[model samples]
Target: MTDQQRAKPLRALVYGDVDLNIIDGSAIWAQSMTQGLAAAGCEVTLLLKAPVTTDRLVAPLDGAPGVTLRRPYEEKLLSDLGPRGLTPDQAVTLMTRLDAEERFDLVVVRGRRLASIAAQFEALAGRLWTYLTDVPQNVAEMTSTAVSELTDIAVASRFLLCQTEELRCFLESAVPAACGKSVLFPPVVVVPEGVSGPGAPSERLRLVYTGKFAPRWNTLEMTELPAALDKRGVAAELHMIGDKIHRDSPEWAKRMAKALEGTPDVRWHGGKPRAEALRLSAECDIGLSWRAPEMDASLELSTKVLELGALGLPVVLNRTPMHEDLLGPDYPLFADGDVDAVADTLTLAADPGIYGEAAERCRAAAARFTLEKAAERLRGYLDLAHPTAPAGTDPQRPLKVVIAGHDLKFFTRLADHLMSLPGLEVRLDEWDGLRDHDQYRSRELAAWADVVICEWCGPNALFYSQHKRPGQRLVVRLHRFELYAEWPRKLDIDKVDAIICVSPHYASLTRELASWPADKVVTLPNWVDDRQLDRPKLPGAEFTLGMIGIAPSRKRLDRGLEVLAELRRRDPRYTLAVKSKQPWDYWWIWNRPEEREYYERVYRTVQRDPLLAGGVVFDPFGPDVATWLRRVGFMLSTSDDESFHLAPAECAASGGVPAVLSWPGADTIYSRRWLHDDTAAMADAIHGIVSEDRFDAARLAAKAEITGNYALERVCSLWTDLIVDGTVPEPVDLQGAIAA
Candidate 1:
């Protein structure tokens, strides 16, 4: 066989985790990308983490001229950082060896670590493209000296684009030669469902989207898609691929089962190597992507779209231009903020002729940006030498973002958000312990740290058991989950400089739970990117009530469904929407006993709950939550517990009369003196707010504006000011105080 026909492995690394590869691995973007790369005659080596010797780790790529994998021993940044993360000496040595060897034709970096890029791209440009899965973050952190070191490699190395607008920008920038039309390809891992003929045909259009399970993704809101699909008597199946972490632990296997209970036609796949996911995706039709979770460019499409194409499935996509760019001309556009529009479009898509035609177009479009195309393009770039050569470590160090082990999403995401500011850097270290913190290292991290930001939730401060001097300023923002961690005593009361919270109740709860001196905690509300919020409300949008949450204990999906049933029974002009990230297959759940039990319990609770017999419906996910809320005349939050109702806050901002279900439990910290669990109060609030259309519209706009204050710009500024400014205030009643 010619080299064209000779099978080659396409070495790929996911950097971290995503759902696509969790089950049938195809749910991951890289899985598909790698599969495509392998199919095009490239060998693929995937780096993955697993508890044991990898459960069914080996996978396959079909009909392609290549190979695929799930390597369990691949080196992660932490291991290379140092033996125990003390110095970069080990990392420097590892990068030196990896780059000098240059085994892979291309090195696709997932989340950006400037040090990693500096090590690889600068010294190893001849071998790979600086492929970005997440948006780049360490540019600002590259010290002047670091910049000079990277300048040589960056100048010579090829650049990969993770965003469409950024690709457009690069086209107009000085580095156009370094990156050519930075088109995106999903991470390759093909799983042909391993199911061909004679398989039992399901009644529903099995729609699945698998990947990381996070809050801001608003993935839960996606349930609305199923609701829409259900209207045409089309039974629909939704599957969220990937493991979800419960609390701060990485044991995500059964994490999401709590929230996805009682919902019909949905399932969860525990975790799988990449290639397997593709095979699983093949049996199904339709995939989903809406970057409603955050604005960081890294969240752009990687593989989900391609899997859809590989299956000849049309995607139900978000309006983001990034995904749109990938869709090219093949995507059928849906109005930005209309569930009905989505319903209309999808209903039409369900038609085999209509969807198949569009799917074919998408397939043709997919070919344009497939792994074959991308690898070839990258090959052309790597053949050219770097504009600049490698230098030593940077002198003027980049702004160090001291990431404590807390709020991985918020911190990393915020870092990505903050990195957009002219000059900044982000770094994550495992040494940030409150009580057992190494005296010497903590001092170094803090001393070197330009900004020390801590998430509200995290692991034991036992690591900080050997506390030391505190130099850099600290900014702590609390998410709802942190309040539940066991030992509250180990929290670094003195090390913290700024206490931050996403909601007022979150702030209050921080004070009540941690009992950190009142002066130590402050509230800085959470904000979605400005781009994510501007979707226009749908005209004549009514009858859409959305309840989004992955956990039933806190989010209260059943209660919301109950309320919707009541309302819908009173007037048939009502639709209920629920979104979640659970797998959609019975066998998939049967494999995971913890998750299986979780679903069983939730199902029993919901099915047996007299109030919600036939009321609640599921949507796609939360990305278009505002759109979903606009469809509802009244929004209800009947949660038994909450850190702060993010969806309600968003719904309130969307002008939906948010009916917060008041229940008396741990009310002092999060709920304040508001009516807790009074059904009459819920009705009264809903009644009072629903009638004032004009006022509600203004409130919606105002809520958007008020919420906008929490945007990246504002949040980053809050972080920047706290980090750069010397003098700081202790936490106080931010209830009436103005925030940046």
Candidate 2:
């Protein structure tokens, strides 16, 4: 894991359970990840689990640089070991032999049983990156035996590649061993280049669905969408692509066969190569991904939605939380599994205005998961994990570190960064909530850690302080919320080594409240991964202003509307995109009379005001902010008060200018150039920049400020220095210098 070793391309071994010849989700995932790893500077060896009959799937990777396709079905030793699909034990034995010879830098295994078996081998434990999507998705399905097995696998693997944050949180909560080790490795969409279509939808709607047909997939019911659309006076055509059909029951098989018997409106292309299917999709009007409600409960996201989005086609999918997160709630085509709902959604999508908006949403969402971005993400993980060590150099046993917190969403990237550094073994103890933690697991991880970092000054801090072990380091990061709470008073300050605050203003407040010495309370601002956030802005983004998180009434939603109204009055093209959870969605906040009245007033203002009526768009809350920011040119921070507001910095990193309202202590964290005295000034600044044609220069300057002041690499190194060497980093100055 040294710089010397990293200079050469990493050797990666990828093995999955699916048959590559079959065009299915698992097989597609296997191929995409292999290519993604190769693109990330890895010499990849993709091993086939099932016997190979067709070269259709492996053909693309056969002659690709830094990639080798291996077929056990063709090899002498593998053929002698098995005739058909390789068994779990046999696969492990094969991997063991390969490791002995090839000595792979990374091993990515897909199946659960195979990963569990591979985790038992001491030789391969440190390099294994296990990806298990078939695990029990819910708490009800997570039996004790299941948890125990997953815990063992989590302990052995260097990383657990989770497809979604929901899945990662669920796994970390259910199986405590997996907390800090999991990373989000979503599906990689390789959008075909030079593929173009009409900018607008055709008069006759063209609908398409690709991939295998199964009962759960509701592909059979999809055949009825055309008739439903026809009854609504909408001319429509449904194109079904894929050769595989559900044949477990004779009745089902016969029904599907009849459905595929082509009609004028219903056409079955059977199966085409992945590339051809996408090209066909680009030419269509809408993509159908609606499935049964049972699938809604699953943690996995449909790659079809993203694939369709990549083609700039509006997708009509189930209105699940995950879907809403990907495309905003106002995406216009969300439907239930019923045919009528889907048909109605299609009818709405047929509208020229709605179609254009949905297509743009799809394109924006898909941009975040592109193959190039996937490679960059993988390379970042590798760089963090092997910062400075050589390939075979024997170093002291890696530092065992555990980060305990209820919500580590803000801190997980830091944890991942820490895990990537050489000579650090990281694990997480995920708490159930703010006041709830798994005491047993917390105790276990605390005992094993050389250093423990509690993300929030919550119950975990109190427990860890009371149970501090001799010679073990303990640090806690105190956000603004805990300063007002009783958690700090209950904490044993003597046992805690240091308290981290995000800003000097908060640090001064913490030291005053806790009556702690200056040395004990240090300021380390939140970090933004500039590499991940830096992306191209969308067309006409200069006219689009974005505000993230507008709940609790005090965030000054009214002020944001005022700014938008002023901007739109001057230029009708300007629109304000509010990306946040609706106030009503937060039960605790909505129950308050003042909060309800404030939001109601804001709603009234939006409806009655002509300038703001069609100009304000409320987007659903999701974790895809990096891509979502692409359409936001100027990020607004109009909150009445704040500690270290991170959205402005994040937007700046995304090459967008941040226009911040001058809240108290705002000057300490950000440059004065970004802060404004009021909404009027904020609007004037934004308008001035746009009119003067200095938007690009302003954005670049903002990005530079964020990069120089709060670069993730620099901030993470500071945390690493504290955690590994027990040397606290000096607080960074707002004027581009570190305080003495």
Candidate 3:
């Protein structure tokens, strides 16, 4: 045989229970997989149980390349025997004819009923591959006669692998001929080319959700987001793309619509072409896929999340192991599929800066699950399962990097980065029982870790410090608030191998305040993932100043107001955007007379001052600070004190100039040029950037400083070194540390 003739593409037949034209997940999966296989140099033919029909509502397959789609049975067959219509004899006869004509190399079956029937075909046994889209309950029903004939089984998720093993064990006990054979083959989609860039900032944030609106999908929570955003004075709208009302539960749709009446408007563009749906999604600010935990909580991955991410939309999905695996634990917008949680997530997503960063991250993550990547992965599994394939080498065990914390924002991102490194097994133990002082979970997690990192100097750190076994390294990270709290005082210094402070100033402050050896305190700044933050500034951002986190009195909102009032007096265009939780929202503070008195003073001052009336904009705490910073010309740090003052650095990263008020340790954190001794000098610095054409230069300078000193990669590397190599510096004596 000629070499050219011997190198022909693999010929494979894909069989599924669903029709290709339907607008459901199964149909999409079937079509997309067929296309992917064809693209991967496979001559493919798709066989379906249901016959093709011309319906206006059905999505058209106008340009499916290199794939022959066929229906082996009619719709009437389905009516007689339910969804699994074809008889084993009929299936055998059809396959025999096809095999005779094409001499097929592989037969891929999708559903359990079809797989069981196909398994009985001895001629196709060695070349068969069964893909289990659902649970393996039906697969267990296959007789020993059929089981012995099967070649390989594939599931859509790794979770199904365990379930498959359980099924295999049960079957083996009853039928000796049954063999356990399964592998993971997750659902994949073609990443759309030249999709619109990350969603741009607008006067009103635009949110879109595409998929089924069934009760299990939590469509009600999706519908309620816009109204909740509106309640916070964030002008937003939801564009729901899909079947507006679930065909199965039309009454539930009516109730949802009725509930949303008089709230922010929701435009329902009923189901459209898949291409059109993605294009529409690309135009929106954020994508939502919050579903009830009961629905595919274990085995199935949400294809909607992938679809939205591929289209360049940041997704607000439910918190789950699958989602955390896909987007990282630190992905800002995760909820429990509750209306209130989803609403709060949407509210945070409204910030243009945060939205932009999240959108970028989503797109980057989506790239890994593309059809091409999925096809490659499938090919590897198929190659391994092939009779003539070569043996594979054993891989090294992964590094068990455990990050234990209550506040997971920074640690999540760090853990995600660490996970991508070679031979690492990263896990996040977010201690929610910090308030109750629970140590059970913390101790258990500490025992599992080769390297344990307590994110905050709280109960998690204290518990891990005392409970961490010998040979396990423990690291505690202290931020600004933790220094003031009693937790630091109670922390077991000797148990902790190292301490991470966000800045040199904080490092010094920590040594002075705490009894830890100075050398143990490593000044590893919080990672600022520059890729997520660095973006183009919005128009009029030069006139707008922004302040993040203004809850406590120490943040000095009154000083920020003074600077804003000074600047507005010079230029009416000047405005101050305060992105924080409202003071009154904190019940503990609102209940206290002193704290309430301070908040009331600020509220009265804003109410009385004419300059502050329209110039001051209050935005609730949100996730999209990066996007919010883009619309801010100057990042004002009017805090009485701070360890690292992440807000200014974040603003600079987002192309905003820093205008910091001089505090006790301001010089240690910021450049003297950017720092001001008083509000007038802070206003002067702001005016210099805004009026003297120095905005871009100042912004670039600040970004350069942060990018150089606190890049995410640099900080994460320090952490990786500490965890993997134990290369951290030895503790210096407290007396020497104080002198230094």
lDDT of 3 by residue, 1-740 (tens): 11132236668777666655445677677777677667666678776655555332223333456677555555232334435445655555566667778886677666656665666556776566666545333444555544443322221111112112223333333333232234345667654467664566567878887766778777776777777778888888888876545656678867766644534478877677777777788787788777787753445666777788778788888786556766878888887746777788777776777788777788887777787886775565433332121112111566676787877766766765665554566777876766543466656777788788888888888778888789888888888878989999998898888898877778888999997788888877676767546655656889998989887788889999999899988999999999999878888767878877888899899999998878889986755565466678888888887777888877877777778887776666566667788999989878877788988777777777766666666676667677777666332222331232
Which candidate leads the pack in TM-score?
2
lDDT of 1 by residue, 198-312 (tens): 1222456776676566544545555566776687677777766666433443443233455455456666665555445555665677666554524434444446566556656
- Candidates by TM-score, descending order: 2, 3, 1
Q: In lDDT terms, how accurate is model 1? A: 0.49
Off by over 4 Å in 1: 1-399, 430-447, 457-470, 484-486, 512-515, 538-540, 582-615, 619-635, 652-657, 663-702, 726-740
Give the worst 10-residue stretch by lDDT in candidate 3. 386-395
**lDDT accuracy of residue 640 in candidate 2:** 84
Q: Which candidate number maximizes lDDT?
A: 2
Question: Each candidate's TM vs. the true structure?
Answer: 0.41, 0.60, 0.50
For model 3 the TM-score comes to: 0.50
